[model samples]
Target: MWLYSEIRTLGDIPRHYSRITPAAPALIGADGPVSWSQLDIRSNQIANVVAAADVVPGARVALLGKNSTRYFEILFGVNKIGVALLPLNWRLALPELVAILQDASPDLFFADREYADVAEKAIASSGLRCRVIGYDSTRPGRSALDELMSAASSDDQVVDVNPWHTAILMYTSGTTGKPKGVQLSHQSYLYLRLCEHLEPSFSYTSEDVMLTVMPLFHAMGVGLSLQALYNGAAVAVYSMPDPGKLLALIQHDRPTLLPLIPTVIQMMLDHPDAATADLSSVRVVVYAGSPIGLSPLKRALQAMTCDFIQFYGATETCAGVTFLRPDQHRRGIKLESCGSPLPLVELKVADSDGNEVPDGQVGEFLLRSPSLTTGYHNQPDFTAHAFRDGWYHTGDAGYRDADGFFYIVDRVKDMIITGGENVYSTEVEQALQQISGVQLCAAIGLPDAKWGERVVAVVVPEPNAVLVAEQLIAQCRELIAGYKVPKEIVFVSSLPITASGKVMKSVLRDEIIAQTSR
Candidate 1:
């Protein structure tokens, strides 16, 4: 009922910026940047291209690409006209991608030229209208990204959609199974952004330069980019994630704020250049998407003198409904916890029968927030299951301490029930990451006959790293409960990880099943 319609689109940013700080750099593409007026003008051009294509308001337009400035422009354009933007996963196989496309049934599909072949096959298989454009479109029919800015209108406003109307329908990365489209309303989007806005540290002042390494499709990226631009913060976007390049960008831009995945942070800590990197200007480093192991968490602290705040949330809940501030993390409390609730969010831990658990008991995490997704697209039954009794069941099992700090045990679906005892995968994975030879590790519950499910760890060793399962088990036995340790360790060259850098344990479970069966 309030006026968050004010932050509804890219157009909102220009007027806000012009009034607050006109010359502030609003967007920094890999090539360079544009002022607030330029970003809005650029989005307007993309909107014209969308209009010329005969796309009607309320039409569904699909975008298949990585993190690019053009992609954000397209997002603004499509949403400005009250059309829903669907961004397909670039990593999905063509067959699976085709299935998703069939579901959305988009009016027009734009394939990033980098993924031209895959996108072509995906669109071709689907019976949807489509075209291919170079991410850096220079040729005719290529529909260069710049063309949208030049060939189209510089319109200021389009008909606004209802706050309850859908904007972007982002599908889950589907690490476990088929991706489901998460339906985010314009208001819910604003609510999530407002949670961050509530923070006393937030500012649109010209002094704040934001460095973003997360993908544009991610909830964190979408939330940060829009709100930051609206507030007039200059944002430098990395089209693709690279440990070295990200550090260099931070050094060059001297970003005042950075919200990123733990893996990116760990990589930055590991980079040799970080020792000499010009990070004197960093004030806050917001880390999330996945929990950090204790070792990497410690290293990340030592690597940067910036205040670190770790947030935990999901696409379903916009972003951080809970945050562990730097002060709490440094005070030797909530080390494995994701922190307490944000201003507008509510959290509860519930059991199998949908009963809320005691404060100290581990159970599924559930949420009821103004920012939670409206529902999964076209999946009423799934939505009913997800949004139960006004609470969105997180499918994650965690407990709250007497002081109300939350601790994540593991995903309820990922818990191993070996010998009738529940085991949290993160507990073992954390222990495994500490072993000298272990470079990377993932723990998953594999189907088993003796035990309903057994804990299995897939590990990638460091160069010249060597370790036997027995040695690792002996090490784990001393540190954690025996039931919590992996029953077997399978050495892998690498892990299947999502763009946000969380280890895809569900993928690992499949490998574990095939190997165990044989």
Candidate 2:
């Protein structure tokens, strides 16, 4: 009974600084700032509620909410129990939410008031014996997290969870089939977050504020939020991606770190708010989740004086294993490299047979690190296939240069086969990004009666930007071989992306297939 090994979170309020500086304000909200001590008390109270819920060890608890105080409190509580925390994507459709709820089949579902209706319908349809709890719902049937916290004590409860045991279940953007739950362990997350905590040089400190518009369901959101909490930094969160409001928060809060998706950045640059926002206090602007378009990339560099750190990772990898440092993002290096493997992680390229491929050889990127996930939930076969040879096969085809820098060619599933020739979609997308009119693009394979599958370019042209299909094809023809050129181009307003900020190529492929069939 004495061997309680499961709980690994910083359960107790540690001995932190107090009088070193003035406690003017911390955790900013719409109303005002919440002090550090306040956050700690709420966290402690929530931890008690989680334990009082009778959530046994290894219970799966789904946190379905946006970025708010309640979400933060619930996460702390979940950590206390050492149970698997599944963060649901609020942006997804009701049906999609239901699918994940059913698939995870958690012991409890905690959602935000905004998603209460959807949660109820999804729960009823799936018959998920899940006890529903939310910030706003039935006073008794649906437990308000804050209320529960007030009724409980401020003591930390430890569970017998090993570091190797699964801690989080993050589902990837399921474009083709159902979403796959990636199981990250405490050991992996510890190494991942610990390695990313930046020891500040001069500017940023706990005094600085930050804003996070990125969805909390993804690994990026989790990493950023945890980093701030772990370091006792303050953050101003927004549930929606409103560029104007985000700018106001930036100017109002004088944030030090702003991590967001490229799409959101693009919106801000195009909006009227960009001209007046006082971003002088911003020190680091972290961007990832997808490829950055040249136009927005240039604007972002010009707009913010902060360093741009782009991370290449996924839900299964515990967020980051490779980092494209701000220095490596020069005009010459940006297009060619995704930088080298991080110091805390290991990376290698391997062939289909699991043998390590030679340097500079293009193959599946195999990653072995303490930060990589243990496996997929309830998917033994998928896990076995992915975690072979003591490494997680990233399913990405890329090569490492002589200097040990890694370059992602494209997803193996996204490789376009045209006339018996293989064309990496990233190569084509990179070329398309350089075109004068092309704003966003994705290269996917579409069914062709003559060639089985033809290279298809799905592009989002700039406003009033027009180009003949033939001219676009010629542009690709000049850069790549004739066979590699996109056989057709489909222009759309925007590209469909997953909640984690990854482009859903499966969705694009399906759209192209449907149109081709018609």
Candidate 3:
């Protein structure tokens, strides 16, 4: 058996797996299943081509594409030559893409055929000088990825890649301000895999098939895929998240593991075909990125006969710090808790003065782990503030129970202060979720004359469900204190969510402010 400690760099994964399980399926996509031997050889060919380009060691190579098999090939290839891979989020606007390109300043830019125009616009806008190649395009001046791979040698080259060498430059989701690049090293990802090995809930075998629906740009997507590969399990890539398509794939491919966000989970359960879908092959379903409501969770448990695992963390922590295990779900204990920290991770809830708080008291959550990123890419001052006192401040308000389980309340910045009372938006949102007609809701503070701020709830009702503001407020008051109930309610068709499936609370706040002013 191969141990986690023996793995040094990302390149070692394919090399080791191919030797032991060369004929086994490594990746399954729309095209078909690719064997481990093919994965190793193709990645080597891409690495040789990249090495022959004469780029300096540690150079940034940016990739703009949706989820696909070629993405993984480029990922390993970039790491094989000691260069950092920056997976650009194609969902961002052109200006956002340009800003990131300007900051990364990659030595080479690779884009999929569908995103070539956007890549050209971003490069032209940012004034970045780099060789642009299309992953599957054969345009006039653009070199096709297939041609490059075919021409390069398949033999692996010896490169000096250390554990501390930076492997990825992932950009944080810019909800408040401009996104900052986070520098993650090979050691960080290796440590994360080690942590996963310690937890029984995350156990994987070569026989397991993982269905991946999250975007490759997000940390969750990358971590899940890497975990599958690390364990020598086969992975199936779904380009995007669609409830109907996901169900169809599950029925056809019969993947044993499916990792998704809460939003997608709810959509899958609500799909009309979900009742009759043959999801018996699924053994474990993992969800993360945001808190899931109790109502939706219960419904999902009834619908799908699979163990549910919930993870909690940010991009800085490599997408997981704590996991609510399946055993806890089976026992129905601490349903609201995000659960205990991983084996090698330390968690603390600290006050604004950086002092530890008592259990059951909400405070800012801070974590220390080997899997954490070194710091933000370029902003030294921001990095200093974030990594104070040898802990990465998560900026999330949460508390620990007497049983040692952690519960996330809300973001520190998302707290609502109204009439000298403090209100956590997550708490209010949880209360609102209990209402029968409400499908989704976000709580925010709006400007008020009498009170310092008024709590406002933006809701998206369930289909064919009529909801009145007064009735919803009455229901919320029954569950929580009157002060915590929403003073005003606004109904919308849908909430603005990020590609990773997190609600954009700042955008909602701005829209509410504009509506009140009018």
- Top TM-score hit: 3
| lDDT to native, each model | 0.72, 0.69, 0.83
| Candidate 2 local lDDT, 1-518, one digit each (tens) | 00123214433212131222226343566656656565555666766676677777677888777776556556656755677788887655555567778888888888778777877877898778878777742232245765676678876554545677666788864323445788877677666654564312213346556676666777887766655644557777666557787887788777788887666777777789788778888878877665565566777888777777777777787766677777655443654466676665788888888787888889988887767888878778888977877888877889988888887866775765443233567767776777899988998876553344578899999999987788998877655446667888888899889899878998878877787679
- Which pairs, if any, clash in model 3? none
Task: Name the candidate that leads on lDDT.
Answer: 3
* TM-scores for candidates 1 onward, in order: 0.77, 0.74, 0.80
- State how far residue 205 of model 3 sits from its true place (Å): 1.2
Q: Summarize candidate 1's per-residue lDDT along 1-518 as a digit string, tens digits.
A: 12264566434555456445656677776667767666667767777777777887767788877776666667777777777888776655565578788877787777677777777777788877766544542232345655655777787556666667777887763323345788877778677667766755444455677787677767778776665665567887766456788778887777888887765676676778878888878888887765567777777777777788877778787667888877876675677789888777888888888898999988999888888889988788888988978889888889999888898877765655454343557667777887899999888877554344678888999999788999998887755556667888899898989999988777777776787679
lDDT of 3 by residue, 465-494 (tens): 999999999888765557678999999998
Error of 2 at 275 (Å): 2.4
Once superposed on the true structure, which residue ranges of model 2 sit more than 4 Å away at CA? 1-26, 136-143, 158-161, 173-176, 197-208, 330-336, 356-361, 415-518
Residue 65: error of model 1 in Å?
2.1
Evaluation by lDDT, superior candidate among 2 and 3: 3
Q: Rank the candidates by lDDT, best first.
A: 3, 1, 2
Checking candidate 1 for backbone clashes, the offending pairs are 137-144
- Could you arrange the candidates by TM-score from highest to lowest? 3, 1, 2
